[model samples]
Target: MKEKNQWSSKFGFIMASAGAAVGLGAIWKFPYITGMSGGGAFFILFIIFTLLIGLPLLISEYIIGRGAGAEAISAYKKLAPKTLWVWIGRFGVLGCFLLLSFYSVVGGWVVIYTGLSVSGNLLHASADYADIFDKVTGSAGITILGLLLFSLINVIVIALGVRNGIEKANKYMMPLLFLFFIILVIRSVTLSGAMEGLKFFLAPDFSKITRESLLYALGQSFFALAVGFSCLVTYSSYLKKDVSLPFSAGWVVSMNIFVSLLSGLAIFPVVFAYGYQPTEGPGLLFMVLPAAFSQIPLGGVFLSLFLLLFLFATLTSSFSLYEIIVAAFTANRFRSRKIVAWITGLIVFAAAIPAALSSSLLRDFKIFRKSVFDATDYLVSNLMLPIGCLLIAVFIIHKMDKALVREEFFLGGTAKASLFSLWRFLMTWIVPLTIVIVFLSMLGILK
Candidate 1:
């Protein structure tokens, strides 16, 4: 038997999931990637897929969790027979764990950057910021300290429980995040030569919209919206029965997509204004962003504030990831919630070791000549996410009662009914096929 939890309120659920969706992926990665992919064109494709493909999948996870009123593993078991569907739930949880393994390492970078920003170190090093980033990225000590700090923050939040835990943190953090983001975007757009970056970011060149670009857009949409993760399913288990899953999930995905687009607008103009290449990987934020900030008056202050906002975004998302694992333990027979939180945090800390040490001792322990971080990210993003989402689609459409799904999610009259068919078509055809092609492309088989 599982213990049931009711959400504190409607807004609580939205903020919590939105907090999950609005992570480092949005504030930094989205802008960097959009600029790299030819700006406005990629941004437009990303928005299109987010609504078409991401929204439906978001609703599916919410329905699964709310309708079943169970954790991800139990939800699937109750919703599907004992054949292979059970493994879907397991894989979903595994994906969450795998994600946190590297995500925490990145989360640590945010923490480090936040401290550096506050201390005025970021300003001094903007000239050759790549060298500074390389030093941090290469060090095992800094990474471990960062991972530990991230683990501590997430553990504290999860231990706080639902209303006080996830909801309260999001309610406060989300507003500050948006406020700072707006400020950063404004400051970034005002920089000299910023319009050139905005041109690349906002003015779409349709010629660049190749199949690969479209696929990348779709994948990023899903990941950025936090659609494929079982965290939504786990979080939704606490929802009140009367709540409209589709309406709520739509709002969450919408907000996240908006943030991603806004972030691209905020970042590209700055990147272009400064003549920075966007293909700088994880160092994009650390390296290029500093350069852009240096050219502004009181750039360090603004940059510090911006990175702090980025840190808050990453922390909120990391908190949700920890919540998913803790929910499983809390619902299952194990330690108490506090114990589960601590244990889960410790496990994540352990898993993050390889990625943290990737540039050091773990660099040589490579498969296919890639580091641990690369392997883990590739496996999760290319393989686990798509497979997990496919299982979710099958579970929702094939196994669960579509009529009940219609009643729960499609209750917004005729307009919603039309939307439901679009949702069905995308989940059934568009997303799955595109994921397959994207997976092949990532494996070098598409070329």
Candidate 2:
């Protein structure tokens, strides 16, 4: 029998898992959402929920993955054989497939912009940035080409397998990502009138705390950590039993939070210094940002670095999505990793075509009165995500043996029993209840 691959070191596992956790949410969504919400108040609530719900779920996945000593689907099967429970992992794989398809399209956008940044087109002072963005998204040829290019990168890296591929990529890229962010933040905070943006981001306004904001914070906690996809399960399966699941989860959570802070600092000050609206949402990253960067000294170079930084973040996240599906197929060793990876890449490229054309050739194509890209994002983000998280929480506390979970969680650490009890209390009650409410609210069923 072939031996299952393990991470070469605990640091490698932490970096890979954290890479899986940090994605576009950290780069694009986190900063914008914080701006729209109550800034520091929303951030604090997000941290609370992340620690309360997201952290426990992460630890649970780690325990499950390492405990079973198998891939995503096989772990469930090994733990609960011949039952419907295996569907949990299957659903995760399916969700990841759909996610990767569209995510790569976004990644392709970054790729095109990165090239433009390097070429100085994206920073042209007289250029209509909004019109340029529209043209980019509205061009079917450009979008699909980007999709193919981005997916190809993942295919090649993933084909190399974990230790040489995902682990190594994250270990190097994450530090570079932070360095880029720090340089941008320094430049941003130095801009005249940047203090207002800093105040808006770091100063908590208790008055901005509302029901909707609370829900946004909760959902961001899940989205920001990439918790719902079960990609962490595949990453954690590579972990050694001696590595502390709790410690790894803590670092992942902390790194994600720090990146979120850096993202806010990097963008909000620039937006405010330029008198641009922070609530520009998705356009803030693609449109307003480039224009803002254009006004700075040697802006083209800085913008190129930022775009490449974003591309790195996007690819890191995409690797996990690819791994979840690829791991399932290669777990039993019937298929070669390289072949399966290329096939997976091809499938994602094909699936992403419609989304790539969503704003262009397929602009008229709508599901549920939304464009294909918007519809897919809604399906995966609102529905599949919550259901996956709910199922994980339920599986750990209800379906799985209580004693084994207890034992697995405490395997490598001398943490307090009170901590385990707290994890149990949250997973058993608070986590599911919050997810259900947040899910319903997102679907407009509760509100």
Candidates' lDDT values, in order? 0.77, 0.83
TM-score of 1: 0.90
Model 2 ranges with Cα > 4 A deviation: 1-5, 35-41, 203-215, 295-297, 441-447
Model 1 alpha-carbon drift over 4 Å, by segment: 1-6, 125-127, 206-214, 292-302, 361-366, 410-415, 437-447
What is the lDDT, from 0 to 100, of the residue 334 in candidate 1?
62
Question: lDDT by residue for model 2 over 1-447, one digit each (tens)?
Answer: 243546888888888877877878788778877877878888888888888988999998887887777878998998898999999999999999988777888899998999888887778888777679889999999998888889989999888865776677678888888887787788788888989988888888989887667767776787777777678877777777778888889999999989998888878887787767877655577875686677778888878887886788888888888988999998889899899999999999999999899989989988999988877876776578778889999998888878878887887778789989999999999999998887667567886
Query: Candidate 2 at 65: error in angstroms?
Result: 0.5
Per-residue C-alpha lDDT of model 1 across residues 190-298, encoded as one tens digit per residue:
8888888778877889887766576567667767877676878888887776667777877787789778867776677766666767656666777766776676678
Q: Estimate the lDDT of model 1.
A: 0.77
Pairs clashing within candidate 2? none
Clashes of each: 0, 0
Reference-based lDDT, residue 376, model 1? 84
